[model samples]
Target: MASALSEATSFVPDEATVDRFYEISGGNPLLLRALLEDCAAAQDRETDVLDPCVGGLPGSALTHAVTTCLNRSGQLAVTVAEGLAVLGEAPDSALLARLCGLARFSAMQGLRVLRAAGVVTDLGFRHPVVRTVVLENMVPERRRELHRVAARLCYLEGAESSQIAPHLAAAARVDDPWGVGVLRDAAEEALVEDRDLLAIDYLELAHAFCVDPRQRADIRIRSAVVRQRNDPFAAQRAADELLGMLRAGQLTPAQSLATADVFSGCRRIDGVNEALAALRGPGDGAPDGPAGRAAAVIEYCPPWPGFAPGTRNPALEWEGRSAQRGEEGGTAAEELLRRTVLTDSTLATVGNAVRCLVYTGRPAAARHWVDVFVREAERRGADGWYAMFAGIRAELALMTGDLPAAERYAREGLERLPKQKLGTLAGGLVATQVLALTRMGEYEAGARLFEQPVPEDLFTSEHGLTYLCARGCYNLVTNRLSSALNDFLAIGRRVRDWGIDQPQWIPWRGEAAEALLRLGETTEAEQLLSEQLSLLPAGHERVRGVTLRLFSQTVEVRRRPALLVRAVALLQSAGDRLQLAQALGELAESYCWLGEDGRAWAALSRARGLAEECGAEHLREALLLHQGPIRSEGARADGSYEDQLARAVAQEVVSNQWDGGWRATLSNSEKRVAALAAGGHTNRDISSQLHITVSTVEQHLTRIYRKLRIRGRDQLPVDLQFCDGPTTSTPCRTLP
Candidate 1:
């Protein structure tokens, strides 16, 4: 059939175009030939009939073909074809019945007649071109009327709001009360599904038709709230429109409070405060209501710094209040926030309450709130709220060192984000995922996320802090020290400038100190750590545990052995196994340096076990190097200590050989240097042997010691003799 069509046109279509033709013609040879003849006839004098654009076939050819096909069927069939064309090629039998005001059986017969005539396929109009041709010939008013019918049909069929919205949008008289009401309902449904932009469109259409001033104001407010996630400029316009309504006294007191809530949630702090003040004015009497009390709580105790010009400075006030009221005041506020979470609170109120609970060191309660919100959102099918709550849970899990839970929550949250309309909420989920992967030692995966471009608007929101911190940590692990230092420092500067230096939220100072330490700036590292330590409240045990661990790393191992001990205890108490493993490893090294072999062995064993359990590969490798071989007297029966040591070295050799373990620990260059040094070669001799400078040899040896956790050349492992030997006379035996 394709060959006959090709012969008729004297030109062969590309594979894709041929496939498209087959799809449109439903493999009917006559239809295929007709389409080819049309293409051939429409070709310009110099144009190929099967050129990339299919020789620019005119719409008239399609119109003629569709008209001819429809003429072969009864009027009922023609009407069903038009209905399918109006619905754009996929109208079901029931929708056809609804559109044509016929019985379902009659609609099915009509479809069968059209199908037999080759004007319709199992899917709908045999081809999209056929539908376009039929619709193009439709009169303007008749097309609008058909669209209105289609919208009603979709609504009655329980189609998705996104699916029904476009039909209503295309109706000619969208201001009709029925259309407006449907639009409003569709908008609310879209919002619940997190189709915020879709919701905004429906609300705008409904607002245009709304006759009542209060209803119009309500639509404008709803549009602004949905627009807050995306389209900030549009949101601001809607907010301004609502503010105009407020000034004109068109909005009820409840509506005014709702507007203020929207403004505050969107970070329009000045507008929210203005509305709240108006509601609280002496003659207003609105201040005695529940809305007024909620507004008062926000005004009196803002959770974070406001992002508006001329807004009250809450940071200083919060600091003074913290000092005066202390933990008791925090507990009272937490209880109040908890009660709010249990009530019918807005998204803004719930989010602020969760943040306050976390900030007050009550994560268990925060988790409770998050779980409750997630259940409610799922029950209501509010995908946006579910994503937001899951993101919060991810961040909470990451803070408490629950890497698996953090990754799980982050992935689930990210999947819920609207593909085309991700905002700061999505950014927060990405940050949480990256942080979790990095902490779990999946640096390559985390680095891939770092390479992806972040959204421009994300930096303007609070989630920006999470992104910067995650990026900094990724850089630190990938050995990009300068970049890591700059990012962490930028976070500090931003926190100070914004007057929202909540260390528990970002912990930028502790991160920057680690970067500084890696850069070999010991003095600056100590200063940063000391500053962070002083700022942290003495009772925030989890953060304090982290700060103490960083502090222990800054000073000499022997000078702060006790600090490492304290850090290990705190981390264990907090159940941060990853950091606890790190602290225990450091403590083992200190114990070895202090000549406490038994204590060193115990600490190293515990560290190795924890590292293995947590999948901390780097820590496991380091601990393996620090741990000396275990002695077993039964191996030789009459064994002296030397025989036991020899047995241990043999066991180590077998283990290393099995896993390629020794090679995994040292780089090729370090291996070469260690082998030569173990063969009793001087640094200069090894440098000469390896054709490198003496300083390079020394550097390699230094790295080998660090990798193997040995103090000097004399303590080099017997396995070094097996790495790349020079047939040295020095025996591969235990040191006496």
Candidate 2:
């Protein structure tokens, strides 16, 4: 049959080409013959007609052949074929007949002819290409009306919502309530299956066709909420409609809840209170339901609402109600965290969870939950949710002293949600970024972000408290003491006014005290540190560690080492290497002031190592300033590099023996310099058959300071050997 068609078109087809005939035509010999002849006559020889990906039955010859074959087979078969194309696969015979405007028995006879031609099996196309050809050949208006007919027939026959959605999606709206209801139900089901994009498509279709104004508004609200799962900003297209419906109280209980979710996801704090009102208006139930969940979130809303909560922060009462509010809300937030993760975890749920953990200073727990939120948000493409969670992860890293991780997560989060779209909630991200940069000694980078305008309401949000603290810390480090003090005081006042007492997480008082100490206001610094200490619980080692270290600065020199020792232990137990390094540095100073040379060197050595491990270049430089302090009282504090080397030589001459190890980090030539600078003998040989070369001590000392200064003074492991001059042929003033 293929050969005959090929001959007619003046082309010879091989056996392999005949195989393509079976594949595309589904073994229908008549269809195959026509397709083969069409292929031979085609102008584009490079186009493979057999492969649907390259080309298939969408042109004039294939359409005419299909029409001719169906017409000769009988018009009844053509009717059934068209109906099957509209109704999709395996539709009921009665449904197909009704969609085609034909009787059932007549449609069945047409279906039989289609089966005999191998054009259909089980009342659907024998091949996808066959269906594609028929569907493409269909007239546009006819195809649309048939889809409407198919949808109506499915509805009349009591088909499932899932079964009806596809037809409704393809058909034009006829103002049918049943169609709207099916689309809505199918959209809900699609959400449960995690097909968020599909859910949005269905809701959009339902909204377009819904006749009732309120129904259409409600559909729009649902759509905006669903859209948040992919991109929160995308949902803002209908912001006016959604917010207007919300303000007018036209939404039902369920729609109101969805509206609340949309508002929260978009960072519209102004709308949160109104949504909360609608949620609690008449249908609110137990505190664990949707209303309660939202209430728990609103309870800690930054710029925390007045006494009753969710009132949008107009609180001037300034009562000492912080302790009470913190206890109640902390319990509520912790209780509700696990119940609302992932699918049930809205923006409110995730925010409340992280805030609660931070309130208690449980960084490990906070990191675990934020990680959970991040993975699920990324997988679902929920940009706003992922951004917030990622920022929270960065904040946790900051608290726990993983400075590098803190910087990485914060930069990534800011990238995920650009600062322009970040709104007031961007406070957390900016805070994390600035603080991480401040600690890493990148002041210029941190300053650039400060010039970028953030939302004015940041100072009023809970996130603003953190941002203020970060800014103040930057000020303190950079020597702007007054500005640093003011920022810290602002945080202190807001945290108290807003009724959130989280000494462990909010270290404003400790930070302010440090700034005061630097300004020589010793009395004020000690008072603030004491107040923080009196209020802080013993269980919070992280904040206590930081507070203890800062407080040590104001104490007498004799008492400072004890306080610093405790700070070091506290920070070490809390697993905050960054804070631990700071505490160790302070302790080393205390040991120096007490004239304990050995103890001071040990503390300085450990502190330098910790600073290096934390990648704190600022801390390491600070450690270098302490080398003179840890020396003996008679040792030259203002020693030049050469003078310091002279002292080391004097120690070697008086002792006549030395056994401190040089680390393996030194090169062979550098080791020779160290031994030569030591002892100053006329001649000497240590373990490696190397004689001392004591020329130019200053030159050798310079390299030594740069490399091993951070590891403490003149100390090496048991790796390098040292020998001394002897009066009895020990090479002192006598060459060996």
Candidate 3:
């Protein structure tokens, strides 16, 4: 896997460029090679690869191969292959039969023929490149028809509705009642899978088909909830439309309350307040029901700003000194949970209940609720809900520093994810895996995850915070300080810009402060830590401990050794051994600076033990450095302790400089072009391979020559290997 990735990315110079390649190729090795070959062809001066032949064009060689293969296989095979391409790289034989409107035996025969022709792999197409070529060659109308057939087949096979959703979306128009019902089901399934964008798309499709006013209003409300993270304005528009329906008497009191529930889940605080006011109006026909009371509780005592309204704490306004207020709020929230469990244990209600408990700092209660929800979902055979609940469990485990548990839960959740190209649940599970591995100090394992193509939506507001945090930590551990700082700073900016200033939810400020401190900007680090400390609610002992440890690192070691000790105590209380080990190492250094040899040795010993136990290589190395003769009296006689520390810092800076310089020498794209050129691919061939203009390929070659300090292609070394094969490295053989 590493060799394949390195060959594909050899021309790419940086992490960002590698990420781009992954995004383009979707981590398929064959597709990556095809792109590289096209790039090589484009860069060749002698080859005249036409612009129209690039990418998945109709007359491209790859496309021609696919066309020839299908032509030889007969019409039934051609139809089956086209359906599979539209559905994606792979489709089950049964599902393909349904989509192709063929008998099961005939469909299997067609598949066998395609496989024998080397056009199909067991999983799907022989390569995604072939799939793309086939799909792009089809007429738009034909493609839409295939999608429609695929959607109906998936629905009939009892596949998860999310699997059917994109097909429906691609079909463009669904005016029939059965189509509308399918869309509605797909929307609900999308929501459970956390594919909010897909949910919104399905709901809109359903709305276009529906004639009933109340049903349309319901779809509009649901759309608002799904759109909140990516399109707040759209959510607000949906809210407005629902309000219009309410005033026009198109919705019943119960329906209005349900709409309010949706509004609350979407975090539209103003919408929730308005809905509650309508319910309280004289002769408004608002039923005094559980939904209405829930809305009233949310209106009266809103959650902390940026807290999703779906997870509104019934006890938030009552948790202070007023016992009576606490009881009323707590009772209301608990009653809602009870009713939801007994009467309507819908996925949405169970999810909201779990979030409420978690945000309220009640993990034990939250865990219990989650267990029940998972069991209920299983009983109902709701795989989507089961995956979502399991993901939440993984997140909770991560928060509590249970690395093994988090990994287990995340893996289990991922198993239930639908085989869709873009799924929010899959993104969350991948993020969870990244977080668990990185936090556990497994940097190499975490780095390998970048080999997989990250879904574009993973970078959107819905999952951005988690993605940034994990990436930042990975960068930090890998000694990419500047990159790490950028990621952390982005998190800070995102929170402020979004008006979601709930630090306790993500605690990005603390991570940023750590980065700032490492960069030697102590004043900025101090300010960030101060703000973070202030924002931390009382009783958040674990986060407070983590924040204080970072804070101590920003100040003079001699002046606040006590702060490190206090942080150690707090971390111990929080049961975060990994962090506690880091804190001990910092405390040991502080003690060493203060001329306390005995305390320093004791601290180092404990830290080393914990680091070894947790397999924290970075922390263990630091501990080893401190435990060396540098801490002895003999070292003091040889040189001042300050001088030794300065030398170590200088060494780190010099190492970083060398690494950064090499990384900046050539962009990843230049490297790819250079490898292809050196491997004897013509400029035109490189362009065709990479799907870029020939001029672009030439420009990349020029940049590569300048960066590598080479005068011309002949100057390239004999051993300058391209990833295609080891034997291809002799540039002399490719030269005229």
Instruction: For each candidate in the order shown, give its overall lDDT on alpha carbons.
Output: 0.66, 0.65, 0.62
Displacement of the residue 642 alpha carbon in candidate 1, Å: 28
Order of the predicted models by TM-score, top scorer first: 2, 1, 3
For candidate 2, lDDT tens digit of each residue in 588-670? 78877888765666666677888777767888899879977667343333334223333443443332211222334345666
CA RMSD of each candidate after superposition: 19.1, 18.1, 28.6
**Top TM-score model:** 2
| Residue-pair clashes, model 2 | 4
Across residues 1-736, which tens digit of lDDT does each residue of candidate 1 receive? 4575567655665677777776666665556666765666657555554532241244545456666777767788877777887777555677677787789899889888877766677748766667776676678777888888888777777776566667877674573456777788888777656666677778888888788887888778777777645454455557667878888888877677777766665444445655655565454534566544553445423434342223343433553465334365456556666566322235665666676566556678778888888887777555666777888888777655567788889989877766655565677678889988887788888877667666674665567667888888888988999988888887777666555566654577788888888999876776666556545543444565677677767655565555565566556655667777877777777777777655566666778888777656666887888875422123223324333333433443343321124577777777778877865689989888889999999899888888765577765543254434453432211111
Number of the candidate with higher TM-score, 1 or 3: 1
* Model 1 worst lDDT run, 10 consecutive residues: 727-736
lDDT of 3 by residue, 1-736 (tens): 3345456443424555455545444454444565456655665646543221344554544455556667777988887888788878445677777777889898888888877766676648755667876677688999999888777767767777667778878998774457777788887776565566677788998888788887887777767656543443355467768877877778766666666665544334444445544555454323356544653433322332222333333423333311223334334445566766422224444565566455445566667878887786567555555676887888777665567678778888777655544344466677787888876677778888656676553443335566788788888878788888889888766655444455555688788878777888777776777666545544444576688788777655654454565566656655567787888788778877788765666666777887776655666777898887335554334434334333433442343211123235666776667667755678998898878999999898788777655566653322132222122321111101
Highest lDDT, which number? 1
Better of 2 and 3 by TM-score: 2
Candidate 2 vs. truth: CA RMSD?
Answer: 18.1
In angstroms, the error of model 1 at 434 is 1.6
Q: Which ten residues in a row have the lowest lDDT in candidate 2?
A: 727-736
